[model samples]
Target: MLNTQHYPQMISPSLMGEWIVIASEQEFVQRQQIKTCLDGQTLTLHRDTINGVHVYQVNFESLDMKELNLSVQAAYGFVWLCIGSEKKPLFQLQEYDVEGARRVPCGAYGVRTSPLRGIENFLDMAHFPYVHTGILGAEPETTVKPYKVEWREDVDEIWATECFFTQPLAAPSSPQPQETEYVYRVASPLNAILYKVNTAAEGIIPADVVCLFIQPLSETHIRAHLLMILDDQTSSMTDMVLFQQKIFTQDKPILENHVPLKLPLEKLEIPTKADALATAYRKWLITKNWCYGVHKNTQEEQVV
Candidate 1:
């Protein structure tokens, strides 16, 4: 049986594949509250009744919301408003977009294969050890293989891939001793992930966390919002900020020049086994009935 339990409910750092709907009823609501308009109307947002007020609504169905179990009062984080079939939003949820003056994780970490700027591919599990050499070097032998996984479809759905790593230095090979832990969770709407890699023992603890957000600035440009909580057990804000800035700066020149899949389909069509995750994403997108290569009303596209 296919495990539907692996899917996630919120768009944060642990889940993937989701729908984010936004809508407004009248133009007056837009003028009254100018603080909440993100990406402008590029996002299909409208106004709806909330406690008698025609408030903006954003609905997001993703795997990331799993880690964001905040009180309704905390309305600063990037919010997801759910729009019902009537093209009306049911409620408004919030998230803080900027932290420490850096753009928070908005979505996708697409990299290029060569300077010819020709062949492009989304970084998948296979490249983890190769691309991120220092932290996650290529280790075909030590790769974590999925064993018991699960999937689900609920208010907070999830698609989890659980496995254990077999390291050579400190533990046994069989049954896999749990050393460092890594999980890529996606909540919804945004095309980013919450990355958590942790290693802790007795009294020593280490954790590296990030809310990596990628936003399409325009048809050709993009931005990366890096909200990193690295070495929570040892580093302070001062130490972490500069370190992250350096990393971003190193990637900025290359990441900024990276090409997007904006050209006509025929212009860029290269596929391989490495595109498995992207293929899955495209398939899931088709299920959402998104307007491919054209524009259409999203509310008319939802299955329900």
Candidate 2:
């Protein structure tokens, strides 16, 4: 077993039946067994040549492993596990099938914070000039212009479009600074992706898709699995990986320092225009009655 028994705040019922990223597909392919926890119970993922992948949860009574009935799935180079009787289909990523695009599954990066907070941090554009300075954004152009935020009924996704920001280095292959357009999509409370299209002088290009599939170890612990499908052919694989690692490492400390730890469902802090997407994200959670990893200001939490 990779970890021991979990005794965290119980994951809410509303968050069930949803697909959660468990581990990188390659990780399991390399190491057959990956043991972890979910919903306050310990889980072991075993991949075999004959039986395929089997998930076993710790039997509380006997402290023995009992195989779960549900099956594990592989999508976009990552393994996923669903926790309830009813499982929703994983979100679609058309960018993954695009020809000539580079697929980079950078593996899991741990963060000691709420999964909601992790996703919210990825959706914010205002922090770029400060948090990821000189690479994602720069000074004097930090204004987050008015963007369109909508809840697509058909897809059940929160979409934020018409978002633009000036970046000193938008991608590993970028030669100069440019104005970048972004379309941020929140597939679920813990899963989000942003399509980045940098301004070009000659031809139109497909946006590079960057996805954050969060694995909630508990209410406060998370494994941020970053997957990217890019149109760049010039940059080396090492450069692309380093660029992403650099960006996320910069945001790690800030995410961990959040006072509440879990996202507050109430109006605890005042948000400005730049937080339009984040504001809409919270409202969407309220509509679904999602209670996982969320707290209210009236109810205080003990900070450890």
Candidates in order have lDDT scores of 0.33, 0.79
Best TM-score among the predictions, by candidate number: 2
Candidate 2 accuracy as lDDT: 0.79
Candidate 1, residue 8: Cα displacement in angstroms equals: 32
Per-residue accuracy of model 2 over 1-304 as CA lDDT, tens digit each: 1111251333346556688877776776567777765645566676656465444322222233333234467778877766445445889998787667789887788898888899999999999989988998888888888999999978889999999888999988888998898999999878999999844312223688899999887778888999888887777898888889999999999999998898987888789999999999999999988877786676776432
TM-score of each: 0.45, 0.88
Task: State residue 45's C-alpha deviation in candidate 1, in Å.
Answer: 15
Report the lDDT of model 1 for residue 64.
Answer: 33
Cα displacement (angstroms), candidate 2, residue 35, comes to 1.0
203, model 2: CA deviation in Å?
Answer: 8.2
Off by over 4 Å in 1: 1-123, 138-151, 155-160, 163-179, 201-208, 229-231, 246-260, 263-276, 292-304
